[model samples]
Target chain A: MQWLNLLNANFRKEYIEMKRYLPNTLALLLTFYIIFLAAFFGIMFVGDPASFEANVQYSIVSVAFWSLTLMTMNFIGFSVVTEAMRGTLEQLYMSPMGVWKIMLTRIVGQFSLQLVMMVILLFAAMLTSGQWLSLNPMTTIPILTLTMISIVGVSFMIAGLAIIVKQIQAFLQIFQFVLMALVFIPLSVAPFLAFAPFVKGVDMVRMVMMENLTLSAIPLADFGFLLINSMIYFILGLFVFHRCEKLAMKKGLLGQY
Target chain B: MEKIIEVRGINKQYVKRKTKEVITAVNDVSFDVHRGEVLGLLGPNGAGKTSTIKMICGLLQADAGSIHINGLDIKKKRLKALKHISAVLEGNRNLYWRLTVRENLEYFAGNRGLSRKDVKEQVEKLLKQFRLKEKENELVNGLSRGMQQKLAIAVALLANTEVILLDEPTLGLDVEISYELREILKMIVKEEKRTIIISSHDMPVVQELCDRTIIINKGTVVVDEKVENLLKLFETRAYSIKLGGTLSVAQEQQLLVKFPLCTYEGSSHETVVNINLEKSEDIYDLFDIFKAEGTVVESIDRTTIDFEQVFMEIVKGEKAYAMA
Candidate 1:
C-alpha cells in the first residue's frame, strides 16, 4: 500500500512536469520522430531495394527501442544530477521510504510515461514508413517488462555515479549512443552481447516483433536466460548504486554539484 | 526528558581535492536532543555545525561514532531511523522550485509513502499555518525566499516526524520575514512539541526559540548549555558604571590592566565604564580603581547579556564552558 502511494505520487509528479514542460517534451518527441524519419529515408535512398520492407520494419523497431532504452536507462542519472543542482537531493535522502525506493518509483513512473510517448513514436514511425511490424503486446509486454528491470538496474548504477560525481552530463550525453548500439545491433551478429544489461531482452522483443513469435513459441531457455540476465544486472545495479550512495555520503557529495 | 536524538562521538573529515589535505569538519561531537526540546546548533563558518547536522540527518556518514534517532541507529537502520526525523537542510533550496506550493507539500509527503489523501488535511493545515494558502498554486520559483523557506519547512512538518532539523531556517531573510519566521517557529515549538534542531547564525532565533544551545568552533563542541543559563552566566558578570567624574591617568591604566575587555566613555562631567568581568569578584577590583581615583560613583547597573554576546564570548574566547 505504501509502495502504491509512492508510485501514484511519482506518476502524478511526472505527468504534471511533462505537462508543464510541454515544449521540452514535445521537442523530445519531435527529435525521436526526426530520427525515425532519418532511418526511413536512409533505408529508402541508400539500402538495397530487395530487403526494403524488412529493412524499414527493422529500422522502425530499432528506432523506437533505441529511444526507449536510452531514455529509460539514462533517466535516473539525469534526475540525480538535476536534483543535486537544484539542491533537493539531500532532502530526498531524508525520506524514510529510502532514496532507492523513491528512485525506483520515479523510474517506473518515468518509464510508463515514456512508454506512452514511445508508442506514439512507434505508430508515428510506422505511419511515415508505411511498414508495420507486429507489436505482439502479449509477448512483447512481458519481455519488455523484464528488459526494464535491467534498464532500471543500470539506471541505478548511473544514478549512483551521479550522486558522487554530480557532473555526469558529459558521460550521460555519450551514453545515448552506447544505448543506440546496444538496441540497434542484432544478437546474432554479436552473440556474446547476451550477457549485457537488457541486450537479451531487447533481442528477444525484437525477434518477437519482427518474426511474429508468441511467448510459448520462443524456447524456454531464452526466457530463462533473459530473466537471469535481468536479475543479475538488477542486483548488480542496486549494489553499485548503494555503494555509490555510501561513497557520496562519506564524501559529503550528495548536495554538491 | 526522553531523548529523541542521540549523537555519540561522531566525527567527519573532508579531503581537499587539490591539496589532498584532510580537514576535520566535525570532531568527536556528542549531544542528545530531548523530546519536545528546541536545540540551537550554533557555530562559526567551517565550525562543523553543518557537518554535525548532516550526520544527524543521516545525509553524511561520520568518520567515527554513531547517531540514533528514536533508538534506531542511523548507520544500521537508516531508513527506519529516518522515520523519526526530517530536515530542511538547505532552507528554500530544499524545495522543488518548479513545483507549486501545494504540490511540493503533497509530493514530499508522497515521497515518504504517504498518499495525498493521507496528507490532505495536513497540506491544508500547513498551508494555512505557514500563511501560504493564497499562493498555494504558485510555483515555488515565483514565491519569495521567505515563502519558499516556509513551504520547505511546511514540507518537513508534513512528514509528521518526531524530530525536525532546520539548518539556517532564516539565513537570508530580511529582518521582517526573519522575525515573522521566528514567531511562527515559536508557535510550532510551543504547540507542536516536536524536537527541533535549528542551526543558524541569527542569534535572536537561537535566543528566543532554543531551549538549549550547543556552540561549536573549529570542529568541536565549545559550549553546550541552556540559553537562559548562558545569558545569566554572562549577565551576572557584566556591569555598566556611571561616574560623577573622569578617571585619573593611573586609575585608567589600572582599569585597562585589570579589564582588557572593558570600554569607557568619558567627558568633562560624566564618565561611563562598561565591563564584563571574568569573575563576579573582579567587580571589587574595578571598584578599587575607581576609589583610587576618588571618582564619585553615581550609579552601577548590571548589564543584561543577550545570547549574541554569550556566543561571541564563547566563540571568540574559544572557551570550553563547563556546565553544571
Candidate 2:
C-alpha cells in the first residue's frame, strides 16, 4: 500500500514536471526530427526511383522505431543525473522506500509518458509519408513488452553509472548511436545479432508489421530466446545498479553533483 | 531522559578521486541522543559533522562502528531504524523545486502512508503553520529562499518521526528570516517534544535550542557538555585586565605559556589582556607572571561569555593542546 502511494506521488510529480516544460520539450523534439530523421530520409530515397517507395517505408519505420528505443533508454538513465543535479536525489533517498523502488517508480512514470509520444510519432510518419504502417496491437504488444524489459536493463546500468560518474551526457550520446545500430541493422543478414539486447524483439516486430504474422505464427524458439535474453539482462542490470548505489553512499557522493 | 539513539566508535574514511589519498572524515566519534532532547553538533569546516549526521540517519554507513536507533541496530534493521528519524539536509536542497508547496507536503505525507483525506488535511495544516498558506499553489522554485526553507522543514515534519536531523537549517538566509526560523524552531521544540540534532555554525541557535552539545574538531570529539554548564564553566574563569603599560616580551611569553587561550593587544600608553583559564585557580599563576616583571595591574574584571565565545575557547583549547 505504501509503495502504491509512492508510485502515485512519483507519477503525479513526473506528469506535472512534463506539463511545466512542454514547450521546451516540443521545441527540442521538432529540432531532432528536422535534423536527424529528415536527413536520413533524404539520403535513403535519393538513389533509385524503383526503390523509392520501399525506401520511404523502411526509412520512416526504422527512424520511428529507433527514436522510441533511443529516447526510452536515454530518459531512464538521464533521469538519475537530472535528479542529482537538481539536489533531489538525497530527498528521494531519505524516503522510507528503498532507492531501487524510487527509481522504478520514476522509470514507470517517464516510460508511460514517452509511450504516448512514441505512438504519436508513429502515426505522424504514416500520415506524412503515406506509408500504411501495421497498426495491429495484438501481435505487436507482446514483442514490445519483451523488448522493453531488455531496454530497462540498459537504463538501470546507465542510471547507476550516472551516480558514480556525476556527468553522463557524453556517454549517453555515444550509447544512443550504438542503440540505433542495434535496432536498425537487418537481423536476416546476421542472424547472430538476435543474441544482442533488443535486436530479436525489433526483428520480430518488423516481421509482424510487414508480413502480417500473428503471435501464434512466430516460432517458439525465437520467443523463448527473447524471453531468456530479457530476464538475464534485467537481473544483471539490477546487480550493477545496487552495487553502484552502495558505492555512492559509501563515497558520500549521492547528494553531491 | 531515555536514550533514543546510540552511536559508538563510528569511523569513516574517503579516498581522494585524483591522488587516491585516504582521508579520515569521522574517527571513533560517539555520542548518545536522548528522547525529547535537543543536541547540537558544532564543528569547523571539514570537521566531519555532516559525515557523523549521515551515519546516524543511515544515509552513509560507517566504515567501522555501530549505530543503534530506538534500540534497533542500524546495519541489521535499517528501514526499521530509519523509520524513527527524519532529516532536512544541506540547507534547502531537500525539497522538490518544481512542485508546489502543497504538492511537496502531500507527496511526502503520502509516502509515509497517510490516507488521501488525511494527506489533504495535513497539507492544509502545514501550509498554515509554516505561513505558506498564501503561496501553497506556487511552485517551490518561484518562492524566496526563506519560503523554500520553511517548506523543507514542513515536508520533514510530515513524516512525523521521533528524531529530526537539521543540517545547517538556516544557512545563507537574511538576518530577518534567520531570526524568524529560529523562533519557529523554538516553538516546534516546545510544542512537539521531538528529539532534534542540529548541525550549525549559528551559535545562538545552538544555545537557544540545544540542551547539550558535542563539539568536534579534526574528526574527533573535543568537548561534550551541557550548554548551561559550558557557559558557566567559561564565565567563571574568563577575565579582562588593563595594564599600566606594555609588558616585556619575556613576561608576555610567560603569560602565553601559562594561558595559551589569552589575547594580548598592546600600545605605548596602555595594554589589555583577555584570557580564559581552564580553572578559576589559574588566575594566581597569571598574576605571578605579571608580578615577575614587576608590572603594575591597573584593573582586573571577570568577563561574561556567550555560547560563541565558549565555542571559540573550546576550539582554541584543542589547538593549544595540539601545540603542547
DockQ of each: 0.87, 0.43
Q: Per-prediction TM-score, please?
A: 0.96, 0.88
**Which run of 10 residues does model 2 chain B get worst, by summed lDDT?**
B315-324
> Which ten contiguous residues of candidate 2 chain A have the minimum total lDDT?
A31-40
Candidate 1 lDDT score at position B302: 92
What does the lDDT read for residue B209 in candidate 2? Answer: 98
Query: Against the correct fold, how does model 1 do in TM-score?
Result: 0.96
* Candidate 1 local distance difference test against the native: 0.90
Candidate 2 global Cα RMSD? 4.3
Q: Which TM-score does chain B of candidate 2 obtain? A: 0.86
At residue A39, what lDDT does model 1 achieve? 84
Report the C-alpha lDDT of model 2 over A119-236, residue by residue, as the tens digit: 7776776677666767578998888889888878878888889889879999888987898788778897888888888789988887787767888999999889999998888788
- The candidate scoring highest on DockQ is 1
TM-score of chain B of each: 0.94, 0.86
